[model samples]
Target: MLSLFLVALASASLLPGGSEVWLARQWCQEPAPLALWAVATAGNTLGSLINVALGRYARHFQGRRWFPASPQGLARGERWYRRFGEWSLLLAWAPVVGDPLTVLAGVFRLAWWRTTLWLLVAKGGRYALVLWLADAWLAPYC
Candidate 1:
Protein backbone atom coordinates (compact mmCIF):
# COMPACT_ATOMS: atom_id res chain seq x y z
CA MET A 1 0.00 0.00 0.00
CA LEU A 2 2.75 2.41 0.92
CA SER A 3 4.58 1.61 -2.28
CA LEU A 4 1.43 2.26 -4.27
CA PHE A 5 0.83 5.48 -2.41
CA LEU A 6 4.39 6.67 -2.97
CA VAL A 7 4.35 5.73 -6.63
CA ALA A 8 1.02 7.44 -7.15
CA LEU A 9 2.25 10.56 -5.38
CA ALA A 10 5.50 10.69 -7.32
CA SER A 11 3.82 10.02 -10.65
CA ALA A 12 1.24 12.72 -10.09
CA SER A 13 3.94 15.29 -9.41
CA LEU A 14 6.31 16.69 -12.03
CA LEU A 15 8.46 13.68 -11.37
CA PRO A 16 8.61 10.98 -14.03
CA GLY A 17 6.98 7.68 -13.18
CA GLY A 18 4.00 5.50 -14.11
CA SER A 19 1.70 4.66 -11.25
CA GLU A 20 -0.81 2.66 -13.30
CA VAL A 21 1.58 -0.19 -13.95
CA TRP A 22 2.55 -0.36 -10.32
CA LEU A 23 -1.07 -0.13 -9.29
CA ALA A 24 -2.07 -3.01 -11.55
CA ARG A 25 0.72 -5.16 -10.17
CA GLN A 26 -0.30 -4.40 -6.63
CA TRP A 27 -3.93 -5.13 -7.38
CA CYS A 28 -2.94 -8.54 -8.71
CA GLN A 29 -0.95 -9.31 -5.58
CA GLU A 30 -3.28 -8.00 -2.87
CA PRO A 31 -6.73 -7.92 -4.47
CA ALA A 32 -7.74 -5.09 -2.13
CA PRO A 33 -9.44 -2.83 -4.61
CA LEU A 34 -11.01 -0.19 -2.40
CA ALA A 35 -7.99 0.41 -0.20
CA LEU A 36 -5.65 0.58 -3.17
CA TRP A 37 -7.90 2.97 -5.05
CA ALA A 38 -8.31 5.25 -2.04
CA VAL A 39 -4.58 5.28 -1.28
CA ALA A 40 -3.65 6.03 -4.88
CA THR A 41 -6.24 8.80 -5.08
CA ALA A 42 -5.16 10.39 -1.82
CA GLY A 43 -1.47 10.23 -2.60
CA ASN A 44 -1.87 11.53 -6.15
CA THR A 45 -4.05 14.38 -4.92
CA LEU A 46 -1.47 15.26 -2.28
CA GLY A 47 1.25 15.34 -4.91
CA SER A 48 -0.85 17.71 -7.03
CA LEU A 49 -1.25 19.88 -3.95
CA ILE A 50 2.52 20.15 -3.85
CA ASN A 51 2.47 21.50 -7.41
CA VAL A 52 -0.18 23.99 -6.35
CA ALA A 53 2.14 25.22 -3.62
CA LEU A 54 4.96 25.60 -6.11
CA GLY A 55 2.71 27.56 -8.45
CA ARG A 56 1.54 29.79 -5.60
CA TYR A 57 5.14 30.69 -4.78
CA ALA A 58 6.58 30.55 -8.30
CA ARG A 59 5.91 34.24 -8.98
CA HIS A 60 8.38 35.13 -6.25
CA PHE A 61 11.21 33.60 -8.24
CA GLN A 62 10.27 34.93 -11.66
CA GLY A 63 13.07 37.46 -11.65
CA ARG A 64 15.67 34.89 -10.70
CA ARG A 65 17.98 33.51 -13.35
CA TRP A 66 17.06 29.96 -12.35
CA PHE A 67 13.36 30.36 -12.71
CA PRO A 68 12.14 27.55 -14.98
CA ALA A 69 9.66 29.43 -17.16
CA SER A 70 10.35 32.43 -19.34
CA PRO A 71 8.25 35.59 -19.01
CA GLN A 72 6.54 34.83 -22.29
CA GLY A 73 5.79 31.29 -21.13
CA LEU A 74 4.28 32.62 -17.94
CA ALA A 75 2.12 35.04 -19.89
CA ARG A 76 0.98 32.19 -22.12
CA GLY A 77 0.08 30.16 -19.10
CA GLU A 78 -1.92 33.02 -17.71
CA ARG A 79 -3.73 33.38 -21.00
CA TRP A 80 -4.51 29.68 -21.12
CA TYR A 81 -5.82 29.85 -17.59
CA ARG A 82 -8.05 32.74 -18.49
CA ARG A 83 -9.42 30.91 -21.50
CA PHE A 84 -10.05 27.56 -19.89
CA GLY A 85 -10.56 28.64 -16.31
CA GLU A 86 -10.64 26.05 -13.54
CA TRP A 87 -12.77 23.77 -15.67
CA SER A 88 -9.60 22.52 -17.24
CA LEU A 89 -8.83 20.83 -13.97
CA LEU A 90 -11.07 17.99 -15.08
CA LEU A 91 -8.19 16.91 -17.28
CA ALA A 92 -5.87 16.97 -14.30
CA TRP A 93 -5.57 13.18 -14.62
CA ALA A 94 -4.12 13.38 -18.10
CA PRO A 95 -0.48 12.45 -18.47
CA VAL A 96 1.19 15.50 -19.99
CA VAL A 97 -1.24 18.23 -19.03
CA GLY A 98 -2.44 17.28 -15.56
CA ASP A 99 0.47 18.28 -13.34
CA PRO A 100 0.96 21.68 -14.94
CA LEU A 101 -2.72 22.46 -14.70
CA THR A 102 -2.52 21.99 -10.96
CA VAL A 103 0.33 24.45 -10.80
CA LEU A 104 -1.58 26.87 -12.97
CA ALA A 105 -4.47 26.64 -10.61
CA GLY A 106 -2.17 27.77 -7.82
CA VAL A 107 -0.55 30.49 -9.90
CA PHE A 108 -3.98 31.93 -10.53
CA ARG A 109 -4.71 31.80 -6.78
CA LEU A 110 -7.88 29.75 -7.31
CA ALA A 111 -9.94 28.81 -4.28
CA TRP A 112 -8.26 25.90 -2.56
CA TRP A 113 -11.42 24.07 -1.68
CA ARG A 114 -12.62 24.15 -5.26
CA THR A 115 -9.25 23.10 -6.58
CA THR A 116 -9.08 20.23 -4.13
CA LEU A 117 -12.57 19.11 -4.99
CA TRP A 118 -11.73 18.97 -8.67
CA LEU A 119 -8.46 17.21 -8.01
CA LEU A 120 -10.09 14.62 -5.82
CA VAL A 121 -12.69 13.89 -8.46
CA ALA A 122 -10.21 13.79 -11.31
CA LYS A 123 -7.53 11.79 -9.54
CA GLY A 124 -9.98 9.44 -7.89
CA GLY A 125 -11.83 8.83 -11.14
CA ARG A 126 -8.58 8.05 -12.88
CA TYR A 127 -7.60 5.42 -10.35
CA ALA A 128 -11.07 3.98 -10.52
CA LEU A 129 -10.80 3.63 -14.26
CA VAL A 130 -7.35 2.12 -14.03
CA LEU A 131 -8.58 -0.40 -11.50
CA TRP A 132 -11.52 -1.30 -13.66
CA LEU A 133 -9.30 -1.85 -16.64
CA ALA A 134 -6.93 -3.95 -14.59
CA ASP A 135 -9.76 -6.12 -13.41
CA ALA A 136 -11.05 -6.56 -16.91
CA TRP A 137 -7.74 -7.28 -18.57
CA LEU A 138 -5.84 -9.14 -15.84
CA ALA A 139 -8.51 -10.88 -13.86
CA PRO A 140 -8.13 -14.25 -15.53
CA TYR A 141 -4.37 -14.10 -15.38
CA CYS A 142 -4.40 -13.20 -11.72
Candidate 2:
Protein backbone atom coordinates (compact mmCIF):
# COMPACT_ATOMS: atom_id res chain seq x y z
CA MET A 1 0.00 0.00 0.00
CA LEU A 2 2.80 2.41 0.83
CA SER A 3 4.55 1.67 -2.44
CA LEU A 4 1.31 2.12 -4.33
CA PHE A 5 0.68 5.46 -2.65
CA LEU A 6 4.18 6.69 -3.41
CA VAL A 7 3.91 5.67 -7.04
CA ALA A 8 0.59 7.45 -7.44
CA LEU A 9 1.86 10.57 -5.72
CA ALA A 10 5.01 10.72 -7.83
CA SER A 11 3.08 10.15 -11.04
CA ALA A 12 0.66 12.97 -10.25
CA SER A 13 3.46 15.46 -9.65
CA LEU A 14 5.56 17.16 -12.35
CA LEU A 15 7.77 14.12 -12.46
CA PRO A 16 8.47 11.32 -14.90
CA GLY A 17 6.56 8.54 -13.16
CA GLY A 18 3.35 6.56 -13.51
CA SER A 19 1.43 4.44 -11.05
CA GLU A 20 -0.51 2.56 -13.71
CA VAL A 21 2.23 0.01 -14.21
CA TRP A 22 2.63 -0.56 -10.53
CA LEU A 23 -1.12 -0.74 -10.14
CA ALA A 24 -1.39 -3.45 -12.75
CA ARG A 25 1.47 -5.44 -11.29
CA GLN A 26 0.07 -5.26 -7.80
CA TRP A 27 -3.39 -6.17 -8.94
CA CYS A 28 -1.93 -9.18 -10.65
CA GLN A 29 -0.22 -10.17 -7.45
CA GLU A 30 -3.14 -9.77 -5.05
CA PRO A 31 -6.28 -9.00 -7.06
CA ALA A 32 -7.43 -6.43 -4.50
CA PRO A 33 -8.72 -3.93 -7.04
CA LEU A 34 -10.64 -1.74 -4.61
CA ALA A 35 -7.73 -1.29 -2.21
CA LEU A 36 -5.38 -0.44 -5.06
CA TRP A 37 -7.81 2.14 -6.41
CA ALA A 38 -8.19 3.81 -3.03
CA VAL A 39 -4.47 4.13 -2.41
CA ALA A 40 -3.81 5.49 -5.90
CA THR A 41 -6.61 8.02 -5.64
CA ALA A 42 -5.42 9.28 -2.24
CA GLY A 43 -1.85 9.68 -3.38
CA ASN A 44 -2.76 11.36 -6.65
CA THR A 45 -5.12 13.76 -4.89
CA LEU A 46 -2.45 14.75 -2.35
CA GLY A 47 0.09 15.34 -5.09
CA SER A 48 -2.40 17.48 -6.97
CA LEU A 49 -2.87 19.54 -3.82
CA ILE A 50 0.84 20.25 -3.94
CA ASN A 51 0.48 21.53 -7.48
CA VAL A 52 -2.35 23.77 -6.32
CA ALA A 53 -0.15 25.28 -3.63
CA LEU A 54 2.58 25.84 -6.20
CA GLY A 55 0.16 27.70 -8.41
CA ARG A 56 -0.99 29.81 -5.50
CA TYR A 57 2.61 30.70 -4.79
CA ALA A 58 3.24 31.42 -8.47
CA ARG A 59 0.77 34.30 -8.29
CA HIS A 60 3.37 36.12 -6.24
CA PHE A 61 5.83 35.82 -9.12
CA GLN A 62 3.53 36.82 -11.94
CA GLY A 63 3.79 40.25 -13.65
CA ARG A 64 7.39 40.72 -12.54
CA ARG A 65 9.45 42.16 -15.40
CA TRP A 66 11.91 39.31 -14.93
CA PHE A 67 9.19 36.83 -15.81
CA PRO A 68 7.96 36.55 -19.37
CA ALA A 69 4.43 37.65 -20.13
CA SER A 70 2.07 36.77 -22.94
CA PRO A 71 -1.40 38.22 -22.93
CA GLN A 72 -2.37 35.51 -25.34
CA GLY A 73 -1.36 32.81 -22.89
CA LEU A 74 -3.11 34.43 -19.95
CA ALA A 75 -6.20 35.07 -22.03
CA ARG A 76 -6.41 31.48 -23.16
CA GLY A 77 -6.11 30.16 -19.62
CA GLU A 78 -8.73 32.60 -18.44
CA ARG A 79 -11.11 31.59 -21.21
CA TRP A 80 -10.67 27.96 -20.25
CA TYR A 81 -11.29 28.67 -16.59
CA ARG A 82 -14.31 30.75 -17.35
CA ARG A 83 -15.76 28.05 -19.52
CA PHE A 84 -15.19 25.25 -17.03
CA GLY A 85 -14.95 27.01 -13.69
CA GLU A 86 -14.14 24.70 -10.75
CA TRP A 87 -14.94 21.65 -12.84
CA SER A 88 -11.73 22.28 -14.76
CA LEU A 89 -9.98 20.42 -12.00
CA LEU A 90 -11.30 17.23 -13.59
CA LEU A 91 -8.80 17.82 -16.37
CA ALA A 92 -6.18 17.70 -13.65
CA TRP A 93 -5.45 14.16 -14.84
CA ALA A 94 -4.45 15.24 -18.30
CA PRO A 95 -0.89 14.71 -19.38
CA VAL A 96 1.13 17.93 -19.97
CA VAL A 97 -1.69 20.20 -18.94
CA GLY A 98 -2.77 18.51 -15.70
CA ASP A 99 -0.39 20.03 -13.16
CA PRO A 100 -0.65 23.48 -14.71
CA LEU A 101 -4.43 23.31 -14.55
CA THR A 102 -4.33 22.64 -10.81
CA VAL A 103 -1.95 25.52 -10.28
CA LEU A 104 -4.21 27.79 -12.31
CA ALA A 105 -7.07 26.88 -10.00
CA GLY A 106 -4.99 28.04 -7.05
CA VAL A 107 -3.77 31.16 -8.83
CA PHE A 108 -7.36 32.06 -9.65
CA ARG A 109 -8.28 31.43 -6.03
CA LEU A 110 -11.11 29.11 -6.95
CA ALA A 111 -12.95 27.47 -4.05
CA TRP A 112 -10.61 24.90 -2.53
CA TRP A 113 -13.29 22.37 -1.56
CA ARG A 114 -14.82 22.43 -5.03
CA THR A 115 -11.47 22.04 -6.70
CA THR A 116 -10.50 19.17 -4.41
CA LEU A 117 -13.80 17.38 -5.01
CA TRP A 118 -13.58 17.59 -8.77
CA LEU A 119 -9.96 16.55 -8.74
CA LEU A 120 -10.86 13.45 -6.76
CA VAL A 121 -13.66 12.58 -9.15
CA ALA A 122 -11.41 13.00 -12.17
CA LYS A 123 -8.41 11.20 -10.74
CA GLY A 124 -10.54 8.39 -9.36
CA GLY A 125 -12.29 7.93 -12.68
CA ARG A 126 -8.93 7.73 -14.41
CA TYR A 127 -7.69 5.05 -12.04
CA ALA A 128 -10.90 3.08 -12.40
CA LEU A 129 -10.76 3.21 -16.17
CA VAL A 130 -7.13 2.15 -16.26
CA LEU A 131 -7.80 -0.71 -13.89
CA TRP A 132 -10.79 -1.84 -15.91
CA LEU A 133 -8.77 -1.85 -19.09
CA ALA A 134 -6.00 -3.80 -17.44
CA ASP A 135 -8.50 -6.33 -16.17
CA ALA A 136 -10.00 -6.69 -19.62
CA TRP A 137 -6.77 -6.95 -21.58
CA LEU A 138 -4.46 -8.60 -19.06
CA ALA A 139 -6.63 -10.80 -16.90
CA PRO A 140 -6.87 -13.50 -19.52
CA TYR A 141 -3.13 -13.44 -19.97
CA CYS A 142 -2.56 -13.72 -16.28
Model 2 agreement with the true structure over 16-56: per-residue lDDT tens digits: 68788888888888788899999999999989888888877
Compute each candidate's TM-score over C-alphas. 0.87, 0.86
Error of 2 at 26 (Å): 1.2
RMSD of 1: 2.3
User: lDDT of each model, Cα atoms only?
Assistant: 0.91, 0.84
Sliding window of 10 residues with minimal summed lDDT for model 2 = 65-74
Highest TM-score: give the candidate number.
Answer: 1
Residue 67 in candidate 2, Cα distance off native in Å: 3.1
Once fitted onto the true fold, the runs of candidate 1 whose alpha carbons sit more than 4 angstroms away are: 62-83
Please count the clashing residue pairs in each candidate, in the order shown. Answer: 0, 0
Q: Write the per-residue lDDT of candidate 1 for residues 29-91, one digit (tens) a residue.
A: 998999999999999999999999888998888889998889999888788877776898989
CA lDDT of 39 in candidate 1? 95
Q: For candidate 2, list the clashing residue pairs, or say none.
A: none
Off by over 4 Å in 2: 70-80, 83-85
